[model samples]
Target: MRPLTAQDPDQLGRYRLLAQIGRGGMGQVLLGQGPDGRLVAVKQIHRQFTGNPEFQARFRREVLASQQVTGAYTAGVVDHDAESATPWLASEYIAGPALQDMIAEYGKLTVSGLKLLATGLAMALLEIHRTGLVHRDLKPSNVLLTNDGPRVIDFGIARALEDDLALTQTGTVLGSPAYMSPEQAECRPLTAASDVFAVGAILAMAATGASPFEAASTPQVLYNVLYTAADTSAVPPPLRPIVEACLAKDPAARPTPEQLLDLAGRIEAEPVWPVRIRRHIADCHAEAMAWADGTARSATPQAPAPPKKRWQRLVPIAAGVSVLTLVAIAITGIGQEGTAVAMDDPPLALTDDETRGLDVCALMKPDVLGELGTAVGELVPGGVTGCRVYYLDQSGQKIYFGLETSIPVGETRSGNQPMGTTINWMPVLGRYREALSCDRSVVTQSGLPLALTMTATPNAGNGCPAAERALAAVVRRLAVNPPLRADAPDSVLRMDACTLIDIAATSAVVGDPVRERTPHGCAATGRDGYFAVDIDDRVRPDNVVGGKVRPTTTIAGREVYVHHEAETYCEFIVMIRPTRDDRAEQVHTTYYSTLPDPPDTCDTAAGLLAPALAKLPTS
Candidate 1:
């Protein structure tokens, strides 16, 4: 929650504003305290729409419609004033993480969690339908995944059942495009069945990361919803019936909210949510208390809550009947906005690391390896070509995690057996050597193609599970942008030090380079004696400077730090990018030698870095 700006009013009517909850297309949501020590979510209409009679009418209708809504899985209206200069509505605050964020952070909910979400949402729809209201703007964002269960909020765009008042303009389609049912997408009359279709879509999304009509654009999504059947393969088996029925193009064929409750059965809410979500629920309460105690006065995150009359306070927080809890609160709109790359468009330029994206060493965390009685060992940096992570067990057994980045193919590479399962849509390959070791491969995303093979010597049963779990976590973390180096990067925080090194220049000094890879740089062999061109420039006096340190100029007019210009041992560093962390502050390539003869080592490294730097237009 952001601190109240000068433009913000301290009090809206009788409610005292605390912090900003959120602001949507319609208006701003402020976390406010009521006169009776009750915390409330106050939503004010945007200034642009303040004077419009049509807007006022809709706001009034919303107030009336919301007042009539009384359901367990809903944010009951506390108060409202549509006739005011700046219209506003207050509801019992329902604070919880949006469903989209929750699912994105933690994988899809367990079966129990999904079922709870489905059932609670169904019941909420039942209430809305009973009250002669059609929630035209039902999407993940509107659904608040609260501790008591999923409470369907946001009736700002809800259409009243009894009235023919048309607030929406003709041909201007409303509702979330991805979650829209066939009827809604076609701009046809909507009914409770349409909402049932949305519930199915929501459940499907909860089961799988993607939605039924998920596509690059809204037009494509709409076309798919109209023409193609939902790809329900990703959803778990048990929930297929609900998903299929709700997703049915024929609204009449769909099940009503009552039918869903029957399917949901007699489930009770007793903190059945996962441990992390449970913690969120506690945190939500803590934030609400914090808001009440004036803790949110500063710039700190706060949560939502509800306050009833003193008489209602006597009732337990979650009591009587089945306090159904399920469904996640997702905060997003109809369709994601972004231009889709056309087939004929020029090929998008890729970073060097993305070209050869596999960094097996990047995935290796010593702390995590320690859990399996293993510690991270040497790293075989393969630049963009691919790399390997070595590990040592407590018994000194060697373990290798070989990783290679490549293009997407129809099948897994030869020799690696499939794990018979996929996580986050990527195939997991597994190869076990009795009890000795387990080798695994991960088929990552398209651009960042990766094949991971992990094997542990003298492996026990723990290795397989550990490898699988760790692999899955790594894929999730690295699927988008994984750090491949310690320095800051174009996208991911890190890049391969090998990719940043100059092998050709090092080879020039010592005849032909042996090309031995290391974590940051490489160890190379020269012709006459021994020469090292370490491109991994960790700017330090002793590390970068060879004999005697002094500022010097390069052959190509680049500023550099020179050491031992004459003979014996010589070193030179060519600068690159400046960083605050100092680890990458000075991007320099250093060349060190113990030749005890001629040929300056600093000049050798400088020659290699010059060509690469010269090619960069920005550099």
Candidate 2:
């Protein structure tokens, strides 16, 4: 209902934010990076539910249920702090976008895609049932199509068969009206069959762009779902029978997950299925690529492109190079310190003329692009140019890397702009280069590289000073270190143990040198304390700004304030004192992206902030 603004990184639990991926009635879903640097999705419950014990119980149940169903087809719950004042849950992040989005952007899946989706969904349902839980919400948005396969997510409203109704009162409706089974609609006892029926609804939607039951209002939709038959005519001829059987109002008549898998296998056996799916994924990838490219405004699906001539020799080369190059970039540049440091081994050589030809387009490739160009060309009307990869050689070593295409000049949105710096710190080729390198010591609390500058001008306009200030804030926050020993002058503080009070106190005594109006926030932590400060006054829409603001409070007797107004920028300053009181003192400072206001979802900022915070000494 509301946009997710950013928040203090320390406010969130272990999960670090990456981006605001999606939002729904339940809350905002943020893509986060975990301790292992693996991607995760964190769903924070709306603040309105923070005080509701019933909601908390339900959240706990959802976490439990999701944990029970961790398997191949399901997005597993990785970490959770349900008892926290503001509850949040994290799950392994599936790389691809949602099924609903894919369909809306590139049209419904072809026959083979339908089968893959159906098979995956059925297996997910089987896992959910095995755990004695029902994923009351089984919609297209909850199913994600990753490179590996389809992954089912969002068990926020899942209900266990044996558990008491902890969150919902007797009369409230729980599941999505469009996908709810008859039993779910009537609030009757539900079995795994309920999920089967819901999966059937999902399959129907996937095969055709519309739900089996269509109505303008919730009451109308519920009536259609419970009392009327689905219009199977829209479903492909080969898949109609299976969808119809699954949509049967009677739970007993619905096919089991195993049965659905069998049906999917049968459908896959159809001669047209493989071709249809290949084209569908290719199209979905294309549309996504187009969206990523800023070329397509609308997500409407276009007709599939004609088959291209197979380049037998090019296939293996493309696969190997793409995978190896991306892996190398992500692993090397994502969180490394210093400048572009050379690896012990020499860089892989690009032998093919085509690979060398890629250098013409230097900035279009992203570090981890996968089958995007091919997918986009097939699904969308116009063909997409190749994707580009960008990286900072923070290892202090120079390397040459080629781009697939030349960087577009000026401010046109034709190509996906590489964020941060354009001068490749890690060059595609040529002599050892340092001009393009970002100061590698700059890192978030969680150790991921922070975006030091804007890659492209956003619709909101380019705020270069703001971007530069944000970058400086990150540098300042990370540069501060604590004293090595208790007897050491307070000035020589350990960076990890330093707190806002320490910084402020130090500033008050030594004179604060850095006073830039940074567009981002500042984060620092040390063994004795931790602090997060926003340098800019950018209050997100969801934040409590203006009059409703509260005063600073003391955590462990250390003063903290979420300052909405400051000469340089609106900032939130939190300080915690050391508990040990008698050890060799040291301080650690870690900085990250600017913190957004609440409800705006500061997952990415938080992700960058947490590891640094964790590194801080906690006496």
Candidate 3:
């Protein structure tokens, strides 16, 4: 980003321009701050184009359509002024480099990185196409990469710039010819599939550091795009097939964005982007944060964190529930209010430290449900400290069996005590029925609080019987030495997320931060903002937490995915390692600030994660 120039306006609409982020044939993209204290990328059109009747009409229509394009991967249009003297559009300001810039500076992406890039581009296309618009110019430069994923930009105004044949200006085309499809190159009526074609070229470039249709001159490049068969030999074997299919001369031969999404799913690899690319993203984020802090544009070094402290896991503020709690709440209309637990509340039979290594999945024996039901899929990690299994009942209906170890056990003053029961001499808390669900809890011989839940499908009948049977089996197994999780000695689960970052580190963002403990993580609130750390096993950060995925940046020597929520919150997830069930053992750090802009909540989240991550096991 650069300082504003003499020609740039100090303010536009309700935004105050901060810096010139970029400039192209159409106009300039300025980093602007909205009245609500949100950052936006404001695109101001060239004065010359605003007066053109064709440009004005197309701009207005596309702007309206673009407003409807909302998805995880595309930067949705936030504000636009097509009728203004100098029409401009603003979008969520994404803090990362374009694919073109990334590839140019860092060389080609790894095969794994290419697959991630392909998936994000395909998803972005799906969103744009879903809204009845084609990203006419899907090129490396138009694709922005963030920690979460790729975001397609300029969907509306960019297309508006492609009016008459003169817009292409064969002699000086506005868009990159190398990334254009044959139909777009020939100026024929286009379809969403045309963007798919561009995705293919982009993949080829991202994989080989040069577009498949590259040439010495603009005209030559256009000729190659129109007539040449893309050379995918240099592309990685795994991605060549998809790239070839995308580069097919006939737009119809190209795979749909949905098809690409399916293909991308099969490329199962963690730490999505290449290591160097992740570092580059972190560098960009650091620079952006520096600018946000009103510091001069320069490389800012990540400061060393303070001494680590031994943090004990705190009890949940309220008695925690199983993952099935959400389903029950939806069905029973149970409210979360008046659920807080007091410090003097009854203690769990066992503490988290006593059961941290015990795998809840191990205690759930499939044969225990013999004749009554059969375990469906393999035992999978359910929550931060839990596991669950889906069993098919005799009636062919599926029942969910979830077991969470080391959660806070307590009763509210509103008579919310557990129903007394005994299984194999173990104190069992049972039969907390909620519509189609049966809930149970037990304090193990070691004194850890264990909660079990069984949720049945519609008309599946009472689940408490099977729930009790399963709990009985689990309780029985707990009597013997239970199977321990094959976690690395340095596993993140062994660390207390709440205490990961010392109070000093957390207080840097939110003054005098106070801890707000949860089942598997910790959150701190202060006068200025709130920050948190959560650990879990999941495929993607966005899947567990809803947010717009951004670029992957480096934190504490680990690659972490970044996400934003409502422009006020930011989260960074660090993937520790892949587990037995093909899920990631990841740690998530989040920040929410009331300070305007807050110097990028991402910076705060990264700072919070840095200390915690540095102390995690690396095996």
Candidate 4:
């Protein structure tokens, strides 16, 4: 959990907000301490969203419905205050990482783990359905892997089975595209069966380490959901048939949540979680318990001081002194207007210190992060300060690129032995402390601050050879322009696209959000079509799709290239933050359609871009 920011309230209702665990379109999720010192997750809506009566009513209803769902499989609601200035709800805090994180770390769960996960989810659904609600959003990220068992969470999109809520206009969709059933994908009426299809998709993802319906864009995922069958080929033989049954296209053909529970009874595996996973869970639980004791968890730095000054501190000043102080404040605020901030520092690029041994991952430009934050996900610090790089390989399978600057606490180890012969010169670091292939840590006696690394997950590729190729590319990029440092900054343009774009404002231009996003980009789709805003560094220098890279306009002094093809697609390529000669580290865009025949694409795409870019604090 990240520490609460200065803007965060110290206490919400009876809970003390310790840290911000997550954030979404409507509100923030904080790890809070209840009055009795119990850990709870407090979800508070943003002040702006509270103006919508429909939104307020829907949230109030959902919170009320959630309280009725009490079970081991679900995170039960403990308290809520919808009538407050900012509607908020507090629920049981399960100490675990999201399923997406688990898959990213452990590849796929063991056969034993999968069954346990499915059983818990099925039971959770049965509970939710019994409460007369449908969990509209039930993707991998919605599931948490606690030490005891899996828990379904985030009923924010839930609705009473009978109340449609009119959340979306006629053609717009809801829920995650990759996990949506055929009916949900097509914006048809939903039933309990839609959720069953999603559970099957989740199982396939947990087994194969990716979504069966995942694609390059939102439309693709939706299209796959509507027309193609979920690819459960990689699922374990024992559970494959059960998963297939759940994924059946026809809602009526699929097994009910009760039937799923019966199927889960057949599979068996002791110690439900693998050793590595169990160890991680233990660490998570300990941290959570410690945090409940008032010592906030690791990722938390103390909350920053408020931007506003304390009134008491000004009381001692004279009338004239107070006036001067106000003037100073005004001037300081204006000064922040035209500054580029730290990220724009040209010299602060990633520069290698050969004497300290090569930082291999830094050698190549990594893949652009999508729906997830950063080109990498978790940036772990301390003993081994490093980050994890993720990318879809050529074959579309997700690949990992992990690098850690290791400072071993105890032993001053000697030469390392060969594991896969991929990094023969660089000694094997023993599989990256996690199971990974091509694990290389170049540590000589002189190189005490070791950079332990891994390029791909086990069994995902040519192992060491693939790592070598990725490393070589990094070197090539460095040869062109060396960087100064590796610390990522918080840039408005670099933030998640959903947060960047004003959904309330853009709803007129595009339809409701279908939650179309990548770690680095965001897209919203409706029946008419789709509009997307993406930020990519790859677009710099001649990385344009057709190699027809040419500047067409200057947007707020930054260059832009409008890639418009006849009637089907429109995208405004903008260089938001320039880094080097004619190249930018940040390229923001508004894209409409990958297909053809829509004339209003540019109007909608550019419509959102105009407002979004206007909000950028550019110098």
Candidate 5:
């Protein structure tokens, strides 16, 4: 949670606003304390919509429907005020990360964890459907994972905004495209089964670490949802049948909430989540409690202006770093345009040739952090090349830094007013300020952005200075003779994904293309089709269960698997070699098009993969 900004109200209705949990397209979710010291998440609609009577009516209906949903797996509506100038609804504030954040931070949930989530979600949906309302936007973000169980939030709210939020040009519905059911994608009248479809998608994500209908663009995802069979092959056997039944395109064929409960059976009483997730929940709860007790500062105090010469960056005092204030920074909502800091220095760009193979998990050692007066804790691995280090500073304040590699700087952010400055001579390509954290990324010679994020306890001051110092230390190390990955030359992590395939030849298969690239992947867009190439460690096609068998063939002495999703998309995966864990390091090339008759899209996917296989390292 973040401190309440000056522009925000100190109190709303009978509750006092303590901090902001998050903000979205509609309004903000504020952490509020009631008269009895109970905490609640207050949802305030954007003030601009106050004058719309239709919107007001819809909000009233939403409040009524939400209040009717009372169940163990759902956050109950504790209070509401629909007649207020800017209406608000206060529900039980769940002090845990969203399912989306959990999956993105930690890897896929374990089998037992998946069962817990499935049972809780099914129970929540049953309660929602019992109230004669459907959770139209039942995606991963709306589900909060707590120690007790998963609690569904924002229930019955999406149906109220459907008409106004639909994307007409793209033929997309109001809900998230990846989780939307076939009927929902087509904008047909939704029943309770639509929520079941979303549950299946969420379970798939929890089991496989990717959505069943994931795609580069929103339209492509919608098309896949409407026309393609969901890929539940990666799901474990125990829950595979349940997921498949729930994802059936025909709503009538989908199982009811009661049936899902029966299928899930009794959830084990022992720990449902892994150790990492439990630790995160404990930290979040402690922070929220600190905010409620007024022990934590609401916002970082502004630092005084620096001298006219070189702008000396002031680091935070968390780890006994210099105590001077940092260069003046105006805090604003992330992605919102703010005053840009003007600097005379040229944009900072570091050489990535030597650092390209640096192992993210080994980049920052615990001993190095301990020397800086920090008690480094567990190192949690995230994506393919990301690591999160959780630790406490000199003052015993909780903090975590997420380090990610090989991300395209363009996709991070560009021309952002607030993030236009430099940090420790590094060009700040992106800046994301949350209630109690700050994130910054810098550009590298390879054009892939290196991300270093610092999140502090609610009471702690600005963490940017400490974050900057850490990044500077990393930069200094990389500039010298830093150790690279000791893994084999053929390891996917050591190779540049773009270099494996012929871009010019692949572009011809689609059309003359405009391209955007990632550190380990290549993507191109044509008038009619979108094409991409990626390398990753995953289960071989033959091992994956419950889906239509992927046709396999040999290309250049490497095993190749062809998987098609209706006429919307096609993909071919070339298996390079098996990892120590029995997972295959594979190259995946895909083609997607929304055109009436996509020309040889699968052929294009195969065309790229076949040549890319020849370039794979034999060692």
Candidate 6:
């Protein structure tokens, strides 16, 4: 049978594929419209899995177990076909990103967020266990966070209590090692208690970034799971005991799913918990809304009109006509012909005194500052220009300090004056100053040039200056190298240190900065100056001579400014345009290597990068 691709047949029996949602080790999941146009998730197994009768039986048992489980917290399976050429299963379609993706995009969940997740997941396991099924895989990726609540997914590896064949063969183990229970890791008979332990591990991961038995390798992680106790120092006090008990090496020590649910319910009933969780959700919504608003505002060029009452709509309509007429007059470059609109409360500009009094660096604590600096340093290492650290207290206020340094511009040569360097104090402090409508600048040192400016607008409440000071002190300390660092590695050394002044100045407009993705190539004269190439070939063992041949080659070029679009594991579309330049110069080229059997949905970049390379003009 041919491998499934994006354009392959969509309707599988009664299900209509709407889109490919996600893929995993065992199968591909498609977002489909089922009977009565109800949205459902369809999981299609790979051919290899179908070839094994034991695997098919396991899959059938999972389907049976899923059918038995019913609850708002669990994604109940609606249909399945284990006897089909490529087995498939369908379940209720839950709308939301996976917990893993959400946390990766927006740090660890707050205490309230963690509590809500814990409660929802605990409730889910209660339903699963009631059906006598054990969800062997309960990692972050399997949990979906919807607006209504969390939903558990992926029952491909679930084991039913009555199934004698559920245990792995010989010395092999099933489920993710990071979240596996001690009994599960040791190949002992599984029970509902295993799911409870997995839930605790998931909650701990949500609360803290790390897992209880985090390790560099699978074997080591499994060893930690079966032999050692989890480190709970990083876990918050409220959740420490709960997660620690669940992760206890002995199965009997773990709480039942029902007990966990009760604990989560109690946490949810706390007076302050709801408010904090709501605020976190609100923040997420606001960020998303801001991004949408910005995109809409940029896409449309029209300016918004002032509001008018319904009764006075005609009058405002006439006024709008006059405004457009005036705009036309201004466009003609006859400025005096346009009417002068009256200003509503002339804007009050910030005086120099207010700017100097605005100390934004006091909002962050020393630990947060240190973590921020360390994270940035690790991200770029040799390429980092500067790093700033800051935080806001319970009351929203900025406190920060920064260290600036210059990265070597290009490869170094012996005896050559090291390439020119540039430096600036961390932007965190500067951003706060800017937020307070103040002017700030940095002086150059060690041949590293620097320049910066900031202004800030006060929110409704009074800002915290002590936090700002503490943040600044931390930044300054980080700006200097630790003692006995003369022979330290280049990575250990701080590039530069200096004190700067914040000058008082009139308030200025501080707009959000523009963010751009890495550009592949530049264009000139409206034609392609460079193009990308992609090659796909199979890997061979070192002993094999010309063992594998290239499978395919895709050569593509696009006119400059054309939008690039791609979808993973399926298909990609490249926009092309007629070359305008008479020379017919190819300015840019891109290449993509396709997956042999891409799931209905997959990441486009991962599928494209291996077989792809690009070329650009030297100039």
- lDDT (Cα, 0-100) at 321 in candidate 4: 6
- List, residue by residue over 1-619, the lDDT tens digit for candidate 4: 5666656899988998787675433456777888788888887876756777766776776687678778788888888888999878888877777776667666799988988888888999999899888876677767888767788876655666776435323333346556767766555667899899889998988888878876633345556877787778799997898889988989999999999988887886652877788788777777766666656544455576333222111111111000000000000001112111010000111212431223333432332122211243443321113445666554556666665443331221343443432221223344333344665443322212333343555345345545544543332232223233442364433355566666765665445656454334566766545666655433354465565665465554545566653366666766555554444545456555543455566555656666676665562
What do the candidate models score in CA lDDT, each in turn?
0.57, 0.46, 0.62, 0.58, 0.63, 0.44
Give me the overall lDDT of model 2: 0.46
lDDT-based ranking, best first?
5, 3, 4, 1, 2, 6
RMSD each, Å: 16.1, 22.4, 29.7, 21.7, 22.6, 27.4
Report the Cα lDDT for candidate 6. 0.44
lDDT by residue (tens digit), candidate 2, 191-286: 788888888888888777777775633345567877898998888987889899888899999899899988888874442333433455565455
lDDT of 6 by residue, 452-526 (tens): 221212333323233233333332322221111121132111211111000010001011211111111111111
lDDT of model 6 at position 328: 6
Best by TM-score: 4
TM-score of 5: 0.49
Off by over 4 Å in 3: 157-175, 297-619
Q: Which candidate do you rate higher for lDDT, 5 or 6? A: 5
How well does model 5 score by local distance difference test?
0.63
lDDT by residue for model 1 (1-619), tens: 5566555679988999887765433356777889898888877765645776755765776778778887998878888777777778888876576665566557677777877788789889988999888876565656667766787876655676543233222433345556667766666556778788888887887788556776543356667876788988878777777788888999999989898777655434332467797687677777777777876566444365333322112110121111111111111122332222110011122234543333446556553243334546576644333455666655665566555443222234565665555544345576552344565565433333334445443434446655565565455334323444443445222333345445665566666766443323334566644443343323443243445555676545555566445454455554445433343323334455656565655456566556644432232
Q: List candidate 4 stretches off by more than 4 Å.
A: 165-173, 297-619
How do the residues 1-619 of candidate 3 rate in per-residue lDDT, one tens digit apiece?
Answer: 6777667899998988877776433456788888887777887876746666866775676567567777888776778787899988787877767777677657788877887898898888877777666666566666777878777765543333234335333222223356767766555556778788889988898888777876533345567877778888899888888999999998888899999988877765652887776787787766556666678454465577342211100100111100000000000000111111111111222346535666667655463344347788988766556777788876788888777653444421122344544443334465455445765655432233344443333345666666766765554334323445676677777666666767887897799987755446777889999887777766755344445445677776677777554567787777777775547788877788888766766666777777776677662
Score residue 507 of candidate 2 by CA lDDT: 40
lDDT value, residue 453 of candidate 3: 40
lDDT of 1 at 255: 89
Error of 5 at 476 (Å): 37
Q: Give the TM-score of candidate 4.
A: 0.50
Global lDDT for candidate 1?
A: 0.57
| Selected candidate, larger TM-score, 2 vs 5 | 5
